[model samples]
Structure formats: structure tokens, C-alpha cells
Target: MPTPGFPPSTLDAGGGPIWISELASDDPNHAVHVVRDLEPADALEALGAKPRLFRPCELPRSKPDKWTSLPAAALGIEPGEVPPG
Candidate 1:
């Protein structure tokens, strides 16, 4: 029987802590796990009426839209190319 509201168990895998519940349902054959501290009740409650649901392929490829404009070296720009005071 599958456990409801309970994430999968990832014990003794030598990786990090993982939540089984967050695993995508599409791949039942593969085990699901999540890093520790990734989930918190307070964080979920912050979502209020718009709680996000995780899907197999719905994993985020990048940061949220609001943060896209922020200056980030990873996007590009050599050290000297940046404006200096």
C-alpha cells in the first residue's frame, strides 16, 4: 500500500536527505527522494491559496521571472568587462 501525504523514504543511500512524496508520479519504477530542509510547513503555508504542485517534468529550469533581470555573473560578463568605479 502507498502512503498518503508521506514522501518516499531515502535512507542509507549515501546521498542527502530526500522526501518521497515530492517524487513525480509518472515514474513509479524509479525511487523518489528530496534533500533535507527542502520542505517546511511554514514555507508551504506561505503559499496561501496558491500552493504549487510538483510534476515529473515541471522541475524549474531557472529562477522565477521576477529575478531574471538581476545581474548575475553566471549569465555572462568577464571581470574587466564589468563597469568600474
Candidate 2:
């Protein structure tokens, strides 16, 4: 029951979205964006090959790579050690 040309895919019931990323830290000054595949078919088609029988550690949900909050100065609150101007 396998297709000849198209890659194989299955319905994953207990996994998270699969992201494609390099194993490198993103530059602080120049940030990078990551894309994830939510559908198994899309992932398999992109890969052009079938995945392993049992995938391990399907990766936990991602957290913010960097702090996106406004700077302390913008918040009108300065640090304790710094002199108040």
C-alpha cells in the first residue's frame, strides 16, 4: 500500500510541529527566523524520504530565543548601580 513516487507519511497523533533549523546560535544583533512543518505530509514531501519507524524526542514546544521586552530605559526605570540623570 505504498506509493511509488511520493514520499510516505503517517498521521502523528502525539507529537509537536517539526521545525527545520541548523544547530547554531542565532546572532544577537542580526536575528533569524525558523519555519516549522505542522503537517506530516508536508514534512515528508519536503524531505523526499520516509522518516524512521519511531521518532524519538519529537522536540518540546519552542520558547522565545531572545528577550523581546522593551529596554529598561524605555520603561522609565534605571538600574540601581547606574547614576540617575
Candidate 3:
């Protein structure tokens, strides 16, 4: 049985939730495999790949006297990543 606010799971041989097996087969698109929580530059160096970090929602809001300018990179998400109507 799954607890409220948690994902479903199966019973292990010893009757515990089978978390390890589930993690081993985790969805590639949803999983984040990191040796450590590294900063953007450090993470790129360690993984030899660019690292993407989500910005805080409040960070994008316009200030009291200023207009907001959204970055093109923020609008470069894949079409499939957008929510369906």
C-alpha cells in the first residue's frame, strides 16, 4: 500500500517496499543521477555536459518599478515538455 503524497510500490521478498528495484528501473527522463549536488559550472565539468537549473518562480516576477525581460533560453523548452490543452 502506498502512503498519501507518495508513489506506489511493491512488496519486497522480506515484505518491505521494493524501492531499490524501482529506482534501478526509474524513468530516464524523470531521474537525476548526480555524484554530488554540484554548482552549474562544477556539474558541467564533472559530467562533461551542460547542466540546466530551474529558476525560482518569484525570480521571474516584475519588480515594483521595472518591466520583466524573459530570456530566450527559458523559452527554448521542447514542444513535448509543454502541457497539453
Which candidate gets the maximum lDDT versus the true structure?
Answer: 3
Q: Would you give me the overall lDDT of model 3?
A: 0.39
lDDT of 1 by residue, 41-84 (tens): 44444544234442112333333353231122334334346423
RMSD of each: 13.9, 16.9, 13.4
TM-score of each: 0.19, 0.21, 0.24
Model 1 global lDDT (CA atoms, 0 to 1) = 0.35
- State the lDDT at 9 in candidate 1: 59
lDDT of 1 at 77: 32
Supply every candidate's count of residue pairs whose N, Cα or C atoms clash at under 3 angstroms: 6, 0, 0
Lowest lDDT sum, 10 consecutive residues, model 1, at 17-26
Model 3, residue 7: what's the lDDT? 40
In model 2, how large is the Cα lDDT of residue 80? 47
Cα lDDT listed for each candidate = 0.35, 0.34, 0.39
Across residues 1-85, which tens digit of lDDT does each residue of candidate 2 receive?
Answer: 3332322232122232122221123223443343354565456546564464323233333333343212223343344444233
